[model samples]
Target: MCEIFSKILQVPINHIKPIDYVPAAAAVNRPYDCHLSNNQLINLGININCIGFEDWWKNYLNN
Candidate 1:
């Protein structure tokens, strides 16, 4: 997951922390703002329609 985020956001793995939160979508005009797109989520095998972000993430990580 860290690798995927690093690739999409063009940031180093060290820059990504487990406590970070990124909206599923965000305003791209903001300086240094980043978000995860629906397509990217789908490509990662995560259903974009899935609700409960925190719960889903916990389950994903546990799996």
Candidate 2:
């Protein structure tokens, strides 16, 4: 899911933030928890980008 979303949102898989709660991200305007994963939530800032959705997307897409 994240892989496919990465293509659509134009962001890397590492930048996506996931959680038990979805719909908080999932935006082309920004980079956030764009998809819901069944995996355990282990947030160490490894695969999460806290730069919000829109800003992160802009910066990410620019590169």
Candidate 3:
């Protein structure tokens, strides 16, 4: 997952630190529907747009 993010963002893995509040920021009041084992993998996939983000974000604001 780190590797993929590094490649996509063209940054080194060591430099690609995960944002501490990202999970909490992304999570809503709904139950956490993800499996811990696949969370990183799934997030990486989402980052690469292999999975659409429309359903992921209710009001996605892309800057």
Best by lDDT: 1
Give the number of colliding residue pairs in candidate 3.
0
Kindly indicate the candidate among 1 and 2 with the higher lDDT: 1
Instruction: Name the regions of candidate 3 deviating beyond 4 angstroms.
Output: 3-12, 23-26, 32-63
Residue 42, model 2: Cα distance from true site in angstroms: 9.5
In terms of lDDT, the poorest run of 10 residues in model 3 is 54-63
What is the C-alpha lDDT profile of model 2 across 1-63, one tens digit per residue?
A: 566557657677875566765474663466676887634544543454367556666577679
Give all TM-scores, in the order shown.
Answer: 0.23, 0.24, 0.24
Per residue, candidate 1 scores C-alpha lDDT tens digits across 1-63 of: 666545545678875568566676853556576776688777899966756655556567568
Positional deviation of residue 31's Cα in model 1 after best superposition, in angstroms: 17
* Residue-by-residue lDDT tens digits, candidate 3, 1-63: 556545545676775576767576777686666644657867677553344444333234323
Q: What lDDT does candidate 2 reach at residue 42?
A: 48
lDDT of each: 0.64, 0.62, 0.55
What local lDDT score does residue 26 receive in model 2, on the 0 to 100 scale? 66
Candidate 2 stretches with Cα past 4 Å from truth are: 1-49
